[model samples]
Target: MSSCHKCWHCITKRTRKDATRIVDVKQTKELSSPGAVEVDSPIGLLASTTAAFLGRARRGPLNTPVFIENFSEFRDHFGGCWSGSMLADAVQQFFSHGGTNLYVVRIANNARGARIDLPGPNGPLVLEAAEPSSTEHVRAAVDYDGIEDEKGQYFNLTLQRLAPDSSIVLDQEIYRRLSCQSDNVLFVGSELARSQLAHVCNTVPAHRPDSTGAGYINQTEMGTDGSALSDYDLIGSPELGTGMFSLNKIEEFDLLYIAPSMTSCVPGPAAVLAAEIYCRRRGTMLILDPPETWMSTSDALEGFEEAGYAHPDVLSYFPRAMSSHSATREESIAIGGAIAGLLCKLDRQSGPWEDLDQQGFELSHDLLPALDIPASEAHRLVKGGLNVIVGQRPGHAMVCGSVTLAHGSQSGDQFTSLTTRRLCLSIKNAVDSVTRRTVFKLNTAAVKEHIVADVRKYMDELVNAGALKNDRFSVDCDTNQGEKRINCTRDITISLTFDPACSDETIKLNICQAKSDSEVASQYA
Candidate 1:
């Protein structure tokens, strides 16, 4: 448990990253950064970057999940891990595209941690950063101010995590009244066990560490950021919680975009399959980027059909978005971030049921599609269940097509439209939220009625907001659908099946109450 004191600097030409005692350097008081929007259960990402700690720790008693609150805070901590890291660009694309509800998992190959050695009465005292990084500017200071220790064996320690290229502190922690003896009540080892910054590397010295904040101190040693990520790095072990599996920490996610593992606009086939299955398990959508082989419209169509890349819970966009590297050259980048953000904006501004077919749904950042698609090609791509970028004006482009990878389902074309899937997810989220609060109540007639009434009110709200058909949805609770009695005494479970607007098939969802243990709550009927 550490204090999250943020300064919220503008990050413009004149601002810096600082807050609290360290932020007094910049004197920033309020948060007014543009594109800093807030929403619940935002889009999740798997990024390759360096940090004080990327929150991708091994399973143990001291495991901490790094849940990002907003875009600005993400920039402050993961803005610059190493020189070539894409943490900033990926997040900025999401912002420019208008997505929220973010969770990040930092990955490394053979990374090493930064540490500092201090002078102690008996031996040397060592403290190391929680996560490995070559570019994280971290340091520590020791002070013995007003200690209640009668033997003068207590001292204060301050750890500061600075920006990648500046002196502005991004995170700072102060541990006071810590004793050097292992048997003491306030032992340094036990005190720093809950620290978010650094941990005691070795056993505490026999006596208190000397004061190093005033005089010259042996500063922290720089560690290596290791090499680029591999395919297995992204699809980490499910049990250990690495790579895409790290998302187990987040309860609910609306959209997911897996950044490139090897090169631009591509992840391994095995990784894509793993992510699709994982997204299905979590009851969400995966925004896939075009494979490197799809350089043109005809190629994309042929490649998408030939490859076994069709799933109801997975959606994709075509060609790529041309990002300006300079005034002269523009490189083709994947549209996963932009497409995810556009969907997020659509889900918020319009209803999740509303697709970005028309009505001024535009992509920001002077972006243009990589290949020009004629009307005939666009129609064919839409039939193949892939979206496209159209209207290549200079400053921006339009998200013209909205289709899911699902060509057709057994019940008809309900999952064909991306909006239909989103609408169903929104309803699922609403049910889970309401049922969680009602789960602990006794099972009575009034309680069951109250549950049904709450769900119906939610469905009606979606209808009022132009998200659902007028009379196409229904809710059933505490009743047996099959032989099983809809049984749950200590747990809460709700089974639902409804039709989306202008859809032929019914959407079936069996959502269990969300728990903090990363339990599988949603299943297909």
Candidate 2:
């Protein structure tokens, strides 16, 4: 949003000045250390969805999270995307692979919105699209309808956000009893301020806009989709809250992903590192895609080491899938969405704590691995922190490895397994959610007990669901937490130890996520 940033956008394609080292090694190691945990309370405040996606789209507002319950909703919202658009593919694959709840945040790469002009008595009334995109088509209509103003002082206006195919109205706004006079309460600008489709721009005409024929079918000036996404566009500035940072506005999500593959063109190294850090901070997992450079197994191993991407919170795989692109043509595509969907299905059928290896996780669509990775090669990739998709026949492809990007002395043994890491995240989210309910309550003796009992109850609930091993956990709290209690700080630490049903090791946690007063704890048990 600064002048310098504005110039960065002027470039047709952004290239990383320092690609060899995208992140500070020392800082990354310190952050990834097992001892470091994102303990901020506000980050744990929302009810989380199964997953979320941020990427380039042919439509929708930039950096705004749109919750999608199904694929139909996605199609209806982001209508008429370019053929083979990464976002559209990912969403379609997600539903095909059994994912139910999702949040999509569309990102703009210096795009512009379409504008329209309505004929008015003195001049033209201008209106602009609320969200920029070539596919952001809107139609407006002005009619006298029920107006009694014979002098044509007032007119009814109808606005519709139409799909690119112009077959459906995604959204519609209707305004009645309106006048073009600025002094009138029904002025176009005043009423348009509340419109979702379009808003009035420039100046208001002295009289109402001339009526369009029939209904909301008046066309607007075509918009420009702009250029493809760049690494700068995806990483976005945290201060400006663009790109992944805009996710902070959302209540909650478990996993984050980019629809486009993690190639040098889109996500690249810089974006991947930024996403990993953000995911760790949010207690979520970043479903990293195979870099486009990984055309083969050997290249993937060498590339993995060179990239220095050993974060335990990042999950990645290699050897893209050969998906049917057209009736006679096939194209290679990243399988990140399929993996995320597999995780979602597993999370529901069993739980996030369920061991993925034993789950027999398979790709849903008729997808075949671009490379036929042998068992030995697959094992090597797994050891190197890269998963693989194995298929002997069409529609029989299955993921081979269920590991995080924590390889060789990362010392994050606790998170090496995807199941264990997810178990910890699930436990953390559960504890935070349960404790947050006590935020507004008085920090009294009974309230303190309520906090402890509530958390204990949740742990018990997890045990009942077979996600955790049966164990009695203790909640550590200050004897007094009301008006005046030890430094008068409304903070209490809770410690619990448990074993995850899907994990082989016993886990211990000291959850101190604070707001008002509460002691929350979780462990593998």
Candidate 3:
């Protein structure tokens, strides 16, 4: 980086007085986010959980995404989305493949859990489901015929909170002959607080709830599932700092994934484009799931044409993944989460530069490529800017290609390779971190010399670390000699250029026969 520093110099006036004049002194310095893999994904959580953990991410100027460091926290907060949603499955698979530092952005609209009204002397007491979901139906019954307490006004209160499907009772509580009075030996407030599925409203009845003829009182006005979500719901507003964009508040993340619900409904094109733009701005890679129409190689090409995401910041995986669920076998789910897990695995086990298409790369036990892709078909998909998995069995499911879904004239082959693109991002981030610290320093010779030295030192380390090819890289931060604006006080310019280490994706070999043994040996070698 280079900046011009202005200084005042005293000049003696010929006639009477001394005057101070300003002069521009140009200073030049040459310089370079370094960290492990961090992945972030947007998931829709049950409405009940959002209120329980509202602002749990500690919202402020930097509205950091909620950091889920372990599996238990994920299960406790985001495990069941209504009837055990797809988010639970995706999170389980992500953790199973050694993913760490996972951040989840839970999406929820205005929806409350099931509510029930109990008959009371003063008024009907209202109770709401502990977790938010329309399917969380709760029931209660009063037993006045049970053993009477000392007051003879007490009754047994039995409450049952059913699952989303109402197939099983998630929680049950029976307060034996408990008085409903606010200040009694065993008040309903203290007794009902132990229920896991529902909680009492603010108001408490003065007397015990009347018996409902020994039958359970069902909830009226069941909660609605709220509005149908769209891309806007997921992207949200930057000003409001919600949804996927909220991930920007965090310090750094390596991979970002936004998977569609298991219903096979892909996120709208606008949301996907917004996510792509965010990844580009943050120096992160996005793993995109193929459209529902991408069942075959031809379909994948057509899908790319329709979507038209000609950006190297994204990697598209094709032919949905086949994994068996407890309820079903050979279920086709979105592969974006699994791909992200693999990327994290690669970054940890092997360096990021290592090709992901090599043999021996394994997938989770339950996952497999949905389609039995032949070699020719796989090649066709790879050329069309889509990554493909070639194998069919566990520990044999190797990623056959690692290409980005980029096309058109402006895009070049250099960015088409995922490794090369990631390397370029890594270099830019490293250099920016160092140079931004020297923004307003004095433009003196000593400063310039130190800046250049610092930059060269970092670049040299990168070269030694195999991130850069050699010392052919150069850092130029001096003022432009040809420009008259070199004297401009406010102008600062920086130019950084380097050749990132690129891996060969293909090799060619030729075989020939010779008459003599020596010649044949030489040719073979």
Candidate 4:
């Protein structure tokens, strides 16, 4: 009996040690290569260059996504990242609320702008703004006395983007000892290419412009902000990669926000649908601002019907949050940016699992819900899949509901839960990361078994961590016996199922009272 007890003890200890080793190995693998669960995604913003005025710099590739760090970068490339531009304002809101990463896509129409002249031995050299902005003003000076090389081809050049008064230099660049000759050491092309203010044009000048130190050279033509961006502008060309499609250049993003711009046009129905499709394809969520026309709940409902949006991947805030414009005291600005910022904050702190409603999130500026929605209207709005911003004061502002613009099944209460949808996305993304590794391998049972094992491992971890209800997930990768094998389609089909972790938003309390002792005695008798 003593020997048997000792043997049992040793076996139990060995099992425990083996379990710990397995757990340690799993954790180390997860840390070394962070799967979708560990990596936080960035948000993508597609708007007009007017939203990000980069002084004299021409806008980025018409449809390319430009990664920006903060308001300074937005201002450096687009102009003022905020101010009156709705897109800029939304970006500010996103950051204030707690978003860390931002990718900006600056769109323009008919890219044209001003040109400045410089003196060159070959002819007249022309300099143009790197980006198009009506507010941009460039002034250059030739330092005839500052020629560094004995070649006499080297001279100093200074450029500036000046204020309206021409006194304050908004931005400036200086190139010393540059030569017009292509063979020269500091060729003009290479030197001026580094200039953020302007670039040397390819055309050779017939004659050099005046080198007067008293006044600076000015631009010949001003740029236009162009007409309001159409759906095509927001949808962008997949081939050219301009507009929202530019986000494809990146591997993944957390959110897609398309706010109005100085152009005054919000995304139309077509643009909204395109954004939904793109978000769905990329595993990102869309944060849509309300149309200016949605002044009332009825208006919003009517518009929602017209748009016919029913995807679970899109969320729209209503009536547009309003705040005092930073530039102008009396004018009220849109609150879309503030809401985006708050959502980012929520995502960072809690991993997008909590409902953004009733958490007491506040907007940066003195922003409030645009309309005073009555109880009935607010209910109607939420039922129709529009999230509402509600609060009496600025700091008190709070998002009232967790909902999306999706209708029918997507509009169902279970599917309407943003937390549930976000969890679903996280699971899908994580599963994708694991299964993608199995691609291009032999289509044998061993491959399928390994795929299933990886998926089950992940799902098991989620269950242990309380992210899933139980070990009830199913992952089937059996493709060898089907038509796929016969046709050599190189197809691997994977099906997954699991119940997501959820929270109880509402609880009911039942109350009852017992009959008096005297009545109970009488009834018994």
Off by over 4 Å in 2: 1-49, 144-154, 162-171, 179-184, 203-208, 211-217, 236-241, 261-266, 324-330, 408-411, 461-466, 469-475, 478-489, 516-525
Top lDDT hit: 2
Question: Against the correct fold, how does model 1 do in TM-score?
Answer: 0.77
- For model 3, how does the per-residue alpha-carbon lDDT over 1-525 read when each residue is reduced to its tens digit? 111112111111111111122111122322212322122121111111000011111001112245564556665444443332355555556667656556665555454656788887777767776555555567878777646466556776667765546546645655565666767766667666655456677687777677787588998758644444567877878778777756645545667776455446677899889988877766678777776656788888887887777788888877877763334434577766666666666666654555677654567767777888888988888887788876776667766677886655254666788777766555444444344334334443443465556656766776676766667766655532333332333222344566666644321111111112111110110
* Residue pairs with backbone atoms closer than 3 Å in model 3 (clashes): 30-451, 30-452, 31-455, 32-430, 32-431, 48-132
Error of 1 at 323 (Å): 3.4
> Candidate 1 residues 39-139, lDDT tens each?
22321111111111122221111222344435666655454322344444555667676665455566766676677888877877888776676665567
Per-prediction TM-score? 0.77, 0.78, 0.61, 0.69
Q: On a 0 to 1 TM-score scale, where does candidate 3 land against the true structure?
A: 0.61
Better of 1 and 4 by TM-score: 1
Q: Against the true structure, candidate 3 has what lDDT?
A: 0.57
In model 1, the worst 10-residue window by lDDT is 20-29
lDDT of 4 by residue, 443-484 (tens): 356656766677667768767756666666676665434433
Runs with alpha carbons beyond 4 Å of true place in candidate 4: 1-62, 81-84, 119-123, 138-224, 262-264, 324-333, 360-365, 409-414, 433-450, 464-466, 478-492, 503-525
Better of 1 and 3 by lDDT: 1
TM-score of 2: 0.78
**What do the candidate models score in CA lDDT, each in turn?**
0.61, 0.68, 0.57, 0.58
* RMSD (CA, Å), each prediction: 9.6, 11.1, 20.9, 19.1
Top TM-score: which candidate number? 2
Query: Which 10-residue window in model 4 sums to the lowest lDDT?
Result: 13-22
